[model samples]
Target chain A: MQIRDLVRRRTPLGWKQLVHSKGRMAIATAGVAFAVLLIFMQLGFMNMLFESAVMIHRQLNADIVLVSSTSRDFASPGTFPRSRLLQAVGVPGVADAEALYVTPRDWIKQSETNRGERAQMLMIGVRPDFAAFRDPEIAAQLPLLVETGTALFDRKTRGNFIPFRQAIERGERPQTELGGRTVTLVGTMQIGSSFGSEGVLIVSDQTFFEFALNRVPSAPSVGLVNVAPDHDAAGVAAAIRARFGTYDDTMVMTMEDFIEHSKGRMRRDSAISFVFTFGTIIGMIVGVVIVLEILSADVHDHLAEYATFKAMGFSNRALLGVVFEQSLILSVAGFVPGLLVSLGLYAVVRSALTMPIAMTVERLVLVFGLAVTMCALSGALAMRRVRKADPADVF
Target chain B: MELSRLSHWYGAGETRRQVLFELDLVIPRGEVVFLMGPSGCGKTTILTLVGGLRSVQQGSVRVAGRELAGANEARLIANRRQCGFIFQAHNLHRSLTARENVRMGLEAQGRGLPPDADERSERMLAVVGLADHANKFQHQLSGGQRQRVAIARALVAEPPLILADEPTAALDRQTGHDVVALLRRVARERGMTVLMVTHDNRVLDFADRLLEMEDGRIVAARPGAAAAAPVNP
Candidate 1:
């Protein structure tokens, strides 16, 4: 027989077995879908955690950045000399250098809105023309923050203490208190809240200096360094690093390197990653257990039939092929409903949590592959019953 | 099909118990031979050994020109393909239709089936008086119809040897007679050898030869029989 005909003839046995009991098949498919949903949710949270951890780092406009050697992350940068940024100006591949003042500032929401909530927000101060934020919406709003004592509120920030996004949507400029000083929310940007900060605000450097109590104008937390087009950013970062290697006070790195640095820190230090990792493993285990139970029952139910096949000259390999095929069917059948449900769940999560949860091609392929592996493993483990199907016993 | 000094036992050490003792049987090509015995007489054991369903433990078992003693799994499978099987339980896969069950027999040959494999299944089902029930599952068929499906599945591949363990035991007397007649007719027409183990006296007339077994021994042989004294193991 041709290969196609051989394949075609042998392929329907598994499907026929699965569909023999419609209720059982439905239950089995539902069980598999539950497994897939669990895997998707856990992995989705992991993806969100990783993506959200690097949100600020990904949005930096500069190709290279200069920070204190003691700096940890965006919200934890130590102070560096402003002259270090100036020293970087003449380096090869350096396009421009601008200071970024980052500090946590306490904000008090007005009681007129029914709650006098106080929160510490990460305040980023930069010049209007050389804004450090990379998003076009924020860049477009930078010119509006040039006015003294005015700032662009992160529209994606959660919490209703000030209605930041709502006010902007209503075409109203709401004034808010930062560090016990009044500041106007003149425009809005789209950097959402992170694990380290409850909210984020951007302001002009002049207003930052005025509102920052006892802070010197000569020192800044970080220096944003843009690389010239046609010049390598890493080379410029290397040049800056070499120039500052002797200073013992500052570190220079490309934006990509800094983002990795932040992500590495989050992965090693945060419980968010740990929880998601554990959840994903648990999901896989649950999936394996459910499939094992279903496949085991299936094998048990069909023991006599398998024995008859053996007596009729069917190879053990061919019989096991039927089980494996059933597993693949269950995996794929359950995965479709699970994926559809997960997509809907993702939308709900994105809307409710205002986090960076999303479905990616890599993640879809990964979970699907894991699901198949999970079911295949269960099928293999369940083949013990198939092996025990003795034709002598059947007779 | 042949069996020589086929002494068989179960378990090991102190739990060991013998089943078949010094069993010697032979059936020539195209002959319908029936081995009639009471319960616990090792009739099924001998059938399984000859069908390559069980390993030969203490004797020689040759069927379709291949010796089964110490045969590897591949060799055993190859030998089994040359024989067809029907059982008292009507061991048809409940999930498959009668037609599909019959096709499974041809598929078991592992050789390329003819393009008219479906037609062959249909024709075989018709021969078994199950043509109208071809698309029915085992659960949907009556006991007799299920047995008929088993018959079709066994004979569909046109195997040289057919091993049946009480093929008509589950059917009514008339149905049993019809099934046995059908089996005899098909075997004679196809020049197929048959070895059936049965305790049912009602179907004895269908066999071309009969051997009566008692306590794992062939105690009586008559009507074209080669008589031999019962040998102890």
Candidate 2:
């Protein structure tokens, strides 16, 4: 039958039934909205967790990257020889390669009011002329790092640094000790913090060796390679990989792959992702239970009316359609408030964690899809009760 | 409509108890028949079987030339579309208005609504003296008015057969008489067959034929008060 004809045969039975009891409708809508809100928050946290893990890798200004084969992730990346970067520069479409030294150090926050408190911070050492960072603000301030014993602090760091950041904004160079050596904060960069480190400190390559007393200068943590214009980074990366075969200690990959690798490691090693996914499933289950309760009660209330419909020659499928329609209405009515509240909560979480968590179109569609599926499943289960309506009993 | 040696039972195995015992009856077109009996005499069971609400377990039931003895669910549903049913409780959907409740009868046939379905429903309501209460929900209407609405709903689709079970059981004396008189007049005007089961003696004059039952058997058959007198008398 044509859809219009099918619709014409229906008398808005589901809508009439729902609106007949205003209080029940409100309760059902609220219940579904609560479940949808829970699912959205869990999904949001899960995506942000992975995003924060690769925040630094995404900010690096390089077409290709080289790391030690033994490196697991950013938190514990092993070092590779500096000679590999020099060898990489000789490849056909290769631009200049820069060495980046990374190490975690304790910063002694020695303020007059608070006795020396220790905070673990990430330290990145780079060349003053060729700092491999994508942000223009950080690149412009790289000249300040040319002086030894000078560092640029990350402005988006996660701990309590209000006084230290205020001092930098006031144009007063703040003095802090890193790994027991005194250093001055010359400027501030805007690389946000990740789960591995609460803050980042950028220093000159000479100062990096001075502060990292156990590390040698000949080895670097990562090699950043830029491709010459009009050449493909993937091709250069393939050549670099061929140069450093399985026997070599270095691993070559495009910058995009490097970021994905970091995220993959985080996903495989962290239990937080599994927790968030479980939370989403739990939300869906709660939604199913709520919808089932509402629908079952509705069917029980109107059992005689449903039997009368059956006695009047209405098929079982048509009767089931009425219940399904109610479910779909609840899903749509509830999703709007859930999405609105989730957006508000997302803003709060982003500000509190300094993480890159925002509502995307894909996530919105995904959560809405999930909500519909949850309600539909409840509708299917409630149909069993509808099928039990016996026309014989109505007489 | 015809029923030949139809038997029905409730429950299974050792708990089984017979309700209808090889009953035989035939109703012609455009006739209004009443089946009257005390409680548990199987009057309502006969009405249910003829209406295709219950399966005929022992014998044959033919309504509108279709056999309903061993019909499947789909066939039974199709047979039900040819008949209208009125229950003891009126059974009006509280969510729908009087006119909308009447319109449901036409929609139940699985055909899209006719272009003039509203006019038909309103006209049916007017015939039953309920035109003014078309927009009122079931709760807003009195007991007698709800029964009239049920009658309108049963007749709006113009089915060939109607089966009513104590349609006036809940109404007052005058209301019950009026309801049956209206049903009789409409059945005669439309040439529709009706089989009603009732214990109310006040409405017996509206029937053309009356069958009295006892112990699942038809004990007597006679002309009702509305029938013409015998020539020899």
Candidate 3:
């Protein structure tokens, strides 16, 4: 009679409905959970793909990149006279600058070692002291490269290409051959930290020119700049690019833009986002349908009882509230498992690969919010029977 | 209270089939009335109308001072708390225990009575010989016992008007007689306005008044030979 008492009494009925018909409810919960897992996996893969693709840009310590107009974006090579590096340094409010070149190509004899894997490896050519803006570990490992005839390899490049089979098969050391040069393995870096050849080779400019005997005029055309710690790099980048022109293609990138550029194709092709977006849509649709049908069937199964309640003088609004609560309870029970299963599956995929598959609290919140809305809408739609069933219709 | 020109039909449009015809009838409040008729003679329809479960289409029905014809939905709902109903199926919510079902009726009126609700429910159950079965589920109890719980649920709300559609139709003759005797005693003791639709002549002795309905019309009304004067108590 009292709304509170009806609710207290009615809650057990929903629980009983869920338990009595475990077969259907279990299947329904599974359907929703499976959908959630699928979406989580898609999102994780997206993160990993972008992280690996943009490793060089992300690790580059450049605040303001000064490049020719023809270059693709920051961390990309720009062929202007070496004077541009000086021009960048002399500009008002300028502090410090470093020059390097980035290029992508198959190993000179990568096929001979059969490590010509599918990955875009970045090539950075700069001075040993210029290592400040190149590979971060370069500054730490300068002593090795200082010994002459030595080089530093980018960890990001190696992680992107080499697998456990080759790394462990060669035991305690993993080395790769590129550009007719046997670049000895110096050290390893963090995951997705490579910029070139699955192994970053750091050599002096004098040594770089010997390897590039047939290449274009290379005066370290790509400059990595360090701003006065207090100045905004993005604002400086915008100002310099507006004033600069590339005899070769050039562009400037803020650290954030560089990272977004790393996720470039994934974000742009829309197909990748489409797959994730598609998973979300399918998840919600399936959740809605399963919830609707199950609750609808529940209403039907309890028709006589509903009529009895009506006969006892319960209002239509009262019955509506019960059904609404019932649907929410079902969704909450189902969603918790759905989210857990999804996170567990994501961990498995991340452990099984060298990709950057990731999960965030925001993603869980999103899925939960969607599930609640879908369940509530489904419940409202399913209450037609409870509202319209006439006690007179029953014997 | 009275039903004038009462008749009911099934379905709509071309498929409609009339089940009851108009017949004038009267029964006073706070009295126990037994509505008897052969199976499918629309005995339940009259009870439904009086209980505020169905709208009266072709007749004027005055129940507890409200017209059954075109009654507002809100008023009709408010009418529910003033009445109690039991069905042939003993329609207690199977998911609830005996006491919870009784509490549900009282709760419907938003008056928990908490500590007292349990005690009152226990007493009502004992009155119907189900005090010990209060914790039992409807499915766990025998059919007759289930009916007793349903009766307790109906009375727990303390409604002045109580209607039953063959409350004991599922019980054996002895159990049926006991159930009716309990209904009679409860009605008289509580001063409840009670009417029950039943084909079970075996329990007719419990009725203070008998109204025989046929073809949806009340053809005769006979008061008990020793109908007691209305007791204020």
Candidate 4:
């Protein structure tokens, strides 16, 4: 018979064997299920963490983020004169220039009125049509923010997730005056993402500076740059470098570089990658043990059958193929259900907890491939006893 | 087949006790011989040596003119395929039906049984008087039936030689003699050279020639043996 047919015919015998001994198959499947589940959990945690990190930077489309070289990252400060904004707009390939502001703030707890927690907020001064604090797609009319006393809030800031039921129930969500007029809470939505789940507020440059006390007067503005169409971001950065000539150790990070910088910052303390690694490591260890145990039991229970096969002149290679096929079948069987469970959990948590759980085809395929490979490898190692078995030995 | 000065010992190096002494003998094709001995007289050792199941140390054994003493692994395996072995205990894959067990032997000959493997297995089972029990597992069969299945397994490969080690040791006297008679009849009908190890002298009536074994050596043959002394084909 062709080897493939033998494997095909023989492994279903493995399934029959499993069915006849339901308890044994269940034990075997449990091992595989847990291993698959582990990999899924890892992917879930990683997606949530990585997507959240990149989302923060992906939503901001600045050409360059000029920060003080002495500043560690967005968490710290580098300030320059507001005149630098005019100089940035005058560059040859420049489209528009705007001053961006960022700093930490206190977000009053939604559940409790008396206590509030520290939350980092990105305070952008809306310049006629800039929806820097909210995704452009979500905002209906960006030009409306140019009014004298108005502000928009990014709902998905640090502990300040927007569906704050408690605050809505209390009938008070911090109404205050700004720029000599009542700044109304027209509407609210997410600005894609942030380093934390805290909230952010946007207003006109006049209203924001007048209302929020954190705006630095030590130096007028943070930094400025233009968004260009045809020119490479690096080229624009270079021109900005020539214009400023590294005065006060200024660091001109291109849009890509800024995104890369934010990613690095998030990665340094990435809780999601940690959770993912934790899951994968646990999965591998658990998978090895389960596969080893299940394989050992099947071989032991069928010692005489394997001995008969050997005595009947089937080579060790043939025996190994049969056993390896059995392992793969068990791995695949358990993985199907395990993956379904993981996907269900991800969907539930994504909608219910307001946290992201990314399910990419590439990652799903990778984890599936890994699950199969892990089973085959560990199963083969466990079945080494069969290959070493002597007909005379087993008999 | 020939054996020359072969011996085996059991236990560890220093504590070892010899089982088979240095012995010399020859078995020929188309010959049905029976060896009778008491327990622990090393009848098993001699059979194991001839079967290529033991490591040949002191001397040589040759089956179908292939040297067994210094034979490499490949040659020994090939020799084993040409011989069919029936032991006292039935060694069958319990998960497989009686037919699959028999077909497994046929499979070992590098032949996939035809689509009619089941029909062919039924024929072999009928030859051993087990056609009615052909679909049952070994555990479902009586001791006599299981032994019949094992005999069917031995013959299914169409081996040139057949060896039975106490083939009926677990059965009643009548069943034991019946199996012995069946073995003799198959040997004569199919031209199989058979060597059976038995402690039961009652089964000796079916042997064409009886060789008495004592102290790991075949001490005597039938009274008219010298004239049959060519020893090889």
Highest lDDT against the true fold, candidate: 2
Worst 10 residues of 3 chain A by lDDT: A105-114
Model 4: number of backbone collisions: 5
- Give the lDDT of residue B138 in candidate 3: 79
TM-score of chain B of 3: 0.90
Model 3 CA deviation exceeding 4 Å by range: A1-12, A20-25, A50-55, A65-85, A108-120, A132-138, A142-185, A191-223, A234-253, A260-265, B110-119, B225-233
RMSD of 3: 4.5
RMSD of candidate 2 to true structure, Å: 2.7
The regions of model 4 sitting more than 4 angstroms off are: A1-16, A61-94, A112-128, A133-137, A141-185, A191-195, A199-261, A268-275, A393-395, B109-123, B129-135, B173-181, B223-233
| Candidates by DockQ, descending order | 2, 1, 3, 4
lDDT of 4 by residue, A15-118 (tens): 54566567877887887888888888787777676565556455564667666656544544455655555666777777766666655444344323323443
- Write down the DockQ of candidate 4: 0.34
Question: Taking the candidates one at a time, how many backbone clashes does each contain?
Answer: 0, 0, 27, 5
Q: How far is candidate 1 from the true structure (C-alpha RMSD, Å)?
A: 4.1
In model 2 chain A, where is the ten-residue run with the lowest total lDDT? A109-118
- Residue B139 of model 2 has an lDDT of 91
Candidate ranking (lDDT, best to worst):
2, 1, 3, 4
- Residue-level lDDT tens digits of model 2 in A1-395: 57766666668888999999888888888888999999999998888878887788888889999899887776567899888888899888997799888998988864444537887788999998995899998899889888899998888887566788888868799897889999999888888877777778988898999999988778899889999998899999999887766648898989889888988887888898799999999999999999899989998888999999899999999889999999999999889999999999999988887988888899899999999999899989988999999999997
Clashing pairs in 1: none
Distance from true position, residue A141, model 3, in Å?
3.3
lDDT (tens digit, per residue) of candidate 3 on A1-395: 56776554443556666676788778767766665566566666666555656655656667765555555443344465566676667666567777665555334323224444544444445666655545455566555444433445443343333453345225434444445555444544443433223444555554455455544434555667777767788877766666565433455666676567546744685466677677667767877887888889888888887887777777777767767877778778777887787777767755544345566787778767777788888888899878877877655
Q: Judge the docking of candidate 3 as incorrect, acceptable, medium or high.
A: acceptable
TM-score of model 2 (CA atoms): 0.95
Which prediction has the highest TM-score against the true structure?
Answer: 2
Q: Pick the candidate with the highest DockQ.
A: 2
- What does the lDDT come to for candidate 3? 0.68
Kindly indicate the candidate among 2 and 3 with the higher DockQ: 2
